[model samples]
Structure formats: C-alpha cells, structure tokens
Target chain A: MTTAKRDTYTPETLLSVAVRVFNERGYDGTSMEHLSKAAGISKSSIYHHVSGKEELLRRAVSRALDGLFAILEEEHACAGRSVDRLEHVVRRMVEVLIAELPHVTLLLRVRGNTETERWALERRRDFDHRVAELLKAAAADGDVRGDVEVRLATRLVFGMINSIVEWYRPEARGASDREVADAVVRLVFSGLRQG
Target chain B: MTTAKRDTYTPETLLSVAVRVFNERGYDGTSMEHLSKAAGISKSSIYHHVSGKEELLRRAVSRALDGLFAILEEEHACAGRSVDRLEHVVRRMVEVLIAELPHVTLLLRVRGNTETERWALERRRDFDHRVAELLKAAAADGDVRGDVEVRLATRLVFGMINSIVEWYRPEARGASDREVADAVVRLVFSGLRQG
Candidate 1:
C-alpha cells in the first residue's frame, strides 16, 4: 500500500460515500471500517476528513435541516395568502427533499439515540411546529379546512411528503425535481376525489 | 448475576421486547447484547429462546404480516361493493396496525437487508397489490375518482396510513383503536378539506 497520499478527497465527496453507506447499513450499524471501505480510503485517512462516524451523521443531518429551514425564509413562503404560503412551503419542501435526497433520507431515519440525534429530533419537531403554525394561520383565514386538528393535519401532510423517499428513485424515473414538486403540491391541495 | 434456572420466555413475549428495541434503535442498529439487556436475560439465554436477532425480526414481521393479510380475508373486505370493501379493508388495516403496534412498526421499518426482511417486503407488496386491485375495482365502479392514477393513489393512501406508526403513541393518546381507525378512514377518504 502506498502510504503517501496523491489527490485528497474533499469532505463533501467523503460525506457522499458515508451517507450512502449509512443509509444502506443504517446510521448505527455503520462503522468506521465500513465507511473506509466504501470511500476507498484508509481508516486513518477518514479521520483526516471527518472526526468519526457521528460527525458525518451530524453533517448530513445538518445539511438536510438547513435546506428545510431555508424554505421558510423564501420570499414565496414568507409573503402570500396564508393558504398560498402554506402551499408554497409544501411544494418547496418536496423540491428541497429531492434535491438533497440522501441528506434528507438520513434526517428522516434518525432514531434519537445520541445527543446529536436528540438535537436533530428537537429541530425536526421545531420545523413541524413552524409549519403547524402556518396551517393554523391558513385555517384562521378560512382558506383551508378548520375541522381537523392542525397538529394532526400537519403530521399527515408531512407524512405523505416524507414517504416519497421510500419509493422515489431519481435515476430510474428521470423525474425532474420540479415535476415531483408539482405532483406533491397538486395532491396536497386537491384531494384525490373528483372535484 | 443469578445462575439459577429460570422459566423460558415465549417467542411472543420475546418478540415484543425485540420489536420495541428494534424500533428504538433501528433493526440493523440492534444486536443480541442489546436484546438481552432489554429482555433481562443473558445473550445465550436469548439464543435459547430464539435462534438469533434476525429470527426475532422474522417472527415479529411475520406476526405483523399475518394480521394485515388476515384483513383481506375478512367477510367485510371480501363481500361488499368495491368501494365499500376497499374502505373496510383500509379501516381494518388502521385498527390492526394500532392493535399490533410494535410488530407492525418492525414490519414498516424493514429495509430488505436479510432473507426475512426480503420476504416481509414481498408480502407487503402483495398486500399493496391486493389493495390496489380494490381501488381499481372502485374506480371501475365509478365510486372513487379516476383522476389520479390508481397506483399513485394507493401509495399515497398507504403512506398516510402507515405513517401512524411514527407518531401514534397508544399509552399517551388515550384514544381507543376504533377512534383512531375512524379518524384515519375519515381523513384519507373524505380528506381534510371542508365541503
């Protein structure tokens, strides 16, 4: 084995490999050795890029959370009729999810074992609460349904959106991010039942 | 540690603990040592109760699959208008899912890593196909809408229903299984939009 390094792998490239392995074996099941093999680098070389396995996890989840939170700050999400804003946020979320598929997939699968995971879970709840507030505003404006509990509606809507990760294969379908986003928006606003 | 002989744990009881831990720290994340710790038994004792960790997983997922498949065989699911039968199956699925929470939770989380998981996935697909056939029948009868693809509609409906496992905590909710099932049926079929 050549001990001398030639071209160094960027942290982003390393993270791409690590997240793939983490998704395959699961976050907890994956080890440094597994990551090293997947990345085609020495175990010691991995440390040169990331502190360890959990650091990779933290970075991955952080990327996902950042993308999601960014949606709330978008102009369309910020300024519109309450229902329209809610729809925009929902549509944007699907786009971001597909764009950052691996990171978001990792975020959705967190089981809250370590401090970092617990923190991720808390932020996730906060994100849900933020959206729930939007739904409540929409309901108050008489734009959306008011009979169902806001919390329950939010959970169900988010569930439908998040479940896309389970079956959506970007490579196979050749589906553009916008197309998926449009489908999600259309389904969410209009019930499957005929109008 | 007490070296005294103890009564053997039944597969059912052992499976309950295993599914809980599996959900707590994903299927791949858990080990025999974790199971033993959770079960208050030695690792070898656990092996005596069940062949291995994967066997426990198989038993748990099998129980869940059996409950779900049994819904299709029921009188209500079998003998009715196509839409009625579809509704009956959907409602019963929610009930079974809540009643057999832990087992079903394990079933939903399987990632097809082992033979047992692959089998569970295949069975799940069979169940989905059965439901989709019902939806197609309903669409043919002009009861349910045909605007959405039957397959896509089935998946979205299933996604909405299956997500209950992630947040539905029975102990804290105080809602009966029937109540939860009713809510799910109402939300999916009727939707959150007020007329």
Candidate 2:
C-alpha cells in the first residue's frame, strides 16, 4: 500500500498534459480516454483533478486571457500618449503570446465548438475591442492615421501580433523575448518601407 | 434514382461542400459520414468524385496554393523594382485571399494531421519562402527597412493579409473586393501613425 503512493496530479499539472494533447489532437479530436492514456491515469482519476475535458480547455484559455488582459492594465500601456500606449500594448502582447504560447495557441485555435470556447472567444473579442479603443484614441489625437478605419487598423495590427504564436519558437531561436518584442514594435510602427 | 442523377456533383462542387464542412468541424473532427450528409450524397458517391476526404483537402488547398503561387509569377510582381514588386504582391495577396476566401480559410486552418495536410503545409512554407526572397531583395536594395529580419517581415505581412478571411463578410458588408484590397494596401504602406 505504501509503495502504491504516487504524487497526486494537481489541476495545473493535469492541465499541462491535457493542453499538450489538445494542441496535438485538437480539442474536438481529444477524448477523456486520450487524456487518461497520456497522463498515465484512469478516466476516473482524471475526474478527480478536473471536471472534464472542457474544464481543462477553459482553464488553459483563462490563463492566456489573463496574461493578455494584464497587459492593458500595465503602466506603460495605460499612461502614455495614445500611439505610444498602443505600441506598449502591441509589444507586450507579443511577449505574453510567446510566454504563454501553448495556452494562447489553443485559445487562437478554438472554433466555438463548446460553451467554454464561445466564452473564450467573447473574452478575446473584448480584448480586441479594448485595444481598438486605444487605436481610436490615438487616431483622434492625430498620432495614428485617421484616414484608415479604426476597426480595420486594429484588426490588422492584432493579426500581425497574434500570428506570432504560429511560427515563434522560443527554445530553438535563441532570441530573447525582448528581441522579439523589439522586432514586432519596429515593424508595426515603421512597417517594411524605408524612410 | 434517376432524379438523384439529375445533377451529378463535380469535383469542384464536392470540394465546396467538403471545405465548408472542414471549416465547420475541424478537419480532424470530420468524417466521411459528415461529408456525405453535407453533400447530400452517398459516401460511395463521394468517393466517385474524389478518392476520399484527403483528396478533397488536397484539391482545396491546391486551388488556394495555386492562386498564391500565380501571384508571384505575374508580370507586375516579376518586373517591378523590389519594393514595388513586394507591394504589388501584398495587394494581390489580399485580392486572391478574398477571391478564394473559403479555400484559403481551409488552407490556413490545416494542422498537418494527414499526409495531404502535411503536403499543403509544405507548399505553404514554399510560398512563404518565395515571398521572403522578395522581402530580402527589397531590404538589400534599401527599399525596405532592414531593421527586422526579412523572414519576420514576410510572416507579419502575410499574417496581415491572411487574417482578412477571418472577419470579412462580402454579403453583409456590401463591400466590393477591390475596396477591401485598396484598404489593405493603404494600411500596409502607411503605418497607423499619422505622417
């Protein structure tokens, strides 16, 4: 009986395994049996750690959403001139996306299949809207171009920033997070065209 | 039975149905049964048009890839100065992506789960490399900023162009494709910052 003792899986540990499987197989493709097999536990054992597969998804996306929303509250993101604040938010978004890559990857790939995914999507839209407001303010202040529609500008900028999750590999590149952030900021502000 | 033969499905029609289903249920989550129901045909009838689900995926992605590759081969794309060529490519990409919105959407969503998906992914990488070469040429010519790596710039710009498929609704917005392309080109060449 004493030898049977193993480190009990916590929600966080179990979530890590589930997110990996989800990312690999996609959420709809993954089943509880798959999670149990990957976690080296029984289906019943998984229930003890989390309610079900959707809970794992919810938890993962919540972590990514928290990291993103935190950026909006940061001093530089809130206190600077509108364009500068927008730049701060953009750079921070790239950093957070890379830092929470897997979770954010899952968040990005959610297709609104379940209630949890729908909620995640709604929160994501809110985040986008909040950032769009910054762009609008910057435009009103004559910092950003007013000729372009505010919504269009926000979506394109977010597209550039969000796409970082698709190809950025922090472990292999040897590029520091700051380096990635700096590159994103420079490209977004000045674009590819030379002055 | 003869009535069912009134209008036989062509490979192109079948692909439209399959891509719709693939977009609805992530490709891995879709089955032959689902495709049959969506196409209003028997599973055997489905195979008569294409070998299987993978073939449908291959055809759809191929159509999208062909459109993209063709853009690079255009006289304008090939004959202009490096920066001008890059600009034309970007604008044309937005147009092609919009024109082939459904196919490109499916192409973007492929996760390399099958042999066909993997092939599609490889071809997509080849397309990216081709564009990156143009970016490199522009940077070398001093027409584009050299501060960001050509690879990163290519990805970000492609990201901006590709993200169009996610939110663009031609029917709802009453917006023509040319209008959208014009907006994208302006936004890309002119940064959000006001001059």
Candidate 3:
C-alpha cells in the first residue's frame, strides 16, 4: 500500500467512511463487505480495528450521545433562569447537531432491532426528558407561555430542532449554523406572527 | 376461515398492518414473511390483496402526499390573506397528520431506497416548496417577520409540525387533534417566550 493511503487509515478515518456508507445503505442493509469496499481495506483489516458492524454502530452512537449529554453539564445549561438556560441548550444543540450531523442522523434512525439500538434509544429518551424538564421549569416560572402544554411544546420544538438532520446540508449554501440557531431561537421564543 | 377472521381481512386492513411492521422494522429489514407473520395471513393471502411490500409502501406514501397536497387547494389556503391562508393550511396539516398518522409517519421515514421511495421524496419536496411560497407571500405582505429567511422558517416550522408523527399516540391520553393544532398555530404565530 502507498504511504499516503496507509497513513489515512486509522480507526477514526475508517469510521468516517463506514458512517457514510451506513447512512446510505442503512445500518441493517450494510454489511462488512460493504464497509470493507467503502474503506478500501480488507475485511480482516476492519476486524482488526472493530469487532464487527455492531461495534462500529455502538461507537458512532456513543459519540453522538456523549456530545448531546455533555451539553447538560455546561454551566450555562445548569445555571441562569430556566428560560435563558433552555435557550442556551437549544442553541448549543444546533451547534452539536451540525458538528456531528452524520453520527446523530444515524442515531435518530435506529429502529431498536438490536441491543445497541435499544440502548441508544434509551439514552436519547433520557436526553429528551432532561431538556423537557427545562421547558417545564420555564413554564412553571411563567417565563414561557403556559397556554401550550410543556411536554408537547418540548417534543414539537425538539422535532423542529432534530428535523435539521433531515435537511440541513453542511455542504449546501444555505444559512450558517449560528444563523439557523438564531432563527430557531427567535421562532421558539417568539411566534412567527407579526409582533 | 372463521367469519370474524374473514371480516378482518381487506386490502386496506392488511396495508395498515404492513405499515406498522414497516415502521417497527426499517422498510429494508422487513420482509414479506414478516408482514405475513404480523398479519397472521399467508404470503399468498397478502399477494392476493396488494401485490407485495412495495405496493404497501406506495399506497401509504400516496395517502400521505394526497392529504398534504389537498391542503394547498383548500379555499382558505387560496383565498385569504397570505398569513391567514398559511395558518389554515398549517392547522389542517396537523389534523391530517393525526388522522392518517401511520401513513404520514411512513412517508417521513422513507430513505429513497427504491423507485417508489424516490418518487415519494420528490412529491414531499414539492409539497414543502408549495408551502414555502405561502410563507414568502406572508413575509412580503409584512405580516410575518422578515428577519429570518422565509425558506428557513418554512422548514423549521415544517420540522416542528411533521414531528408530531414521532411522538403522537392516538391511543395515549395526549392532546386531541384540535388542541395540538392550536398549540402548533400558537407557537408558529407567536414566540414561545413570554410577551
């Protein structure tokens, strides 16, 4: 093998190739042969870095989940008024989602057909509930309108945020990450109606 | 077959069962055997009704697209002020989504794996652009905020609206269709932050 190709073949780099294929063919649809071909490495070589496709899946979701859960640990997420903290979390979520688009997109599409998928789903639910609690607190503080149920509002807003995976192309000449986050926050905090 | 079992089996009824399994198992993972097992009917019986799995997928997405496209043709959608028309379409959309929850859910989850899936995605994009135009008109009339890009706003709003399929359970003691529509309209029109 050439030195340049060999140098670029770390587990992480192989993983980037694996994720792109996985997203394209789908997790279940993808096989080691597919990854092997996509990575330009032998199947045995892929096995050297990871046990199998499941391990790769586990690693990808773990990264995405860690990025999401880390947001809750930040001082801005924990301190300040509930509404302001919620805003901080919302904005950071957009950033994290953009930064880890493929990983999170894969995470969102899991169908719970396997052990790793179920675990990923449970962790996702936990993250959602934590964010929902912030919205609930904001509602209780009367800083957010109480007209809409907090739980429903949280899910819908999340739906809005998470739906970014369906369309936001990091390559597209669309709005930047900060710009999209600003629009989301503005719409979330204030309605689309004329003031 | 018993009279009750005979009564339970129809193309529409069988399609419903197939859609549920298609959602639980990713469409690619699901097989004719899986549908047969889920429906408690033989493979031959299923073929007797709809040809095959692709037919079920086609029917489900067609139903969803039809519901969405019909919204654009409504009198309120066409006759009123741009903002009001958009509001009407948005409200009707939530109702249609709830009414045809499973079908729409299947439509949103499609990954364009086949010719049928690709067509569904194209139709979905067309529907989105049609709504985007309404938002643009509302912006032009100065009835909606001009600060956020209209195309971006349409997508985020759609992301929030389409998200209902993710969590809404017709069986659960959650908000009714009207209540959810009200919340969506309120959030879409006004800011979620307190005045």
lDDT of each: 0.84, 0.85, 0.91
Ranking by DockQ: 3, 2, 1
DockQ of each: 0.35, 0.58, 0.77
| Number of colliding residue pairs in model 3 | 7
lDDT of 2 by residue, B1-195 (tens): 644652677888889999999998878889999999988888988878888999989989999999999999999899978889988988899889988999999999998878999899999999889889988998899988777877767777887788888888777764567776766777666566778
Model 3 TM-score, all chains together: 0.90
Name model 1 segments beyond 4 Å from true: A1-8, A43-45, A50-52, A174-179, B1-5, B8-11, B25-37, B40-56, B174-176
lDDT of 3 by residue, A15-73 (tens): 88888998888898899999988888888988889999999999999999999999999
lDDT of 3 by residue, B1-195 (tens): 755775679998998898999988878889999998999888998888887899999998899999999999999999989999999999999999999999999998898889999999999999989899999999999999988998899999999999999889999999999999999999998978887
Query: Model 3, A105: alpha-carbon shift in Å?
Result: 1.1
Tell me the tens digit of each residue's lDDT in model 1 across B1-195: 344334657677788888999988888889998999998878888888888999889888888999999999999999988888998998999899988899998899888888989999999999999999999998898887766677777777788788888888888864567766766666666665456
TM-score for the first chain in candidate 2 comes to 0.94
Provide the lowest-lDDT 10-residue window in model 2 chain A. A1-10
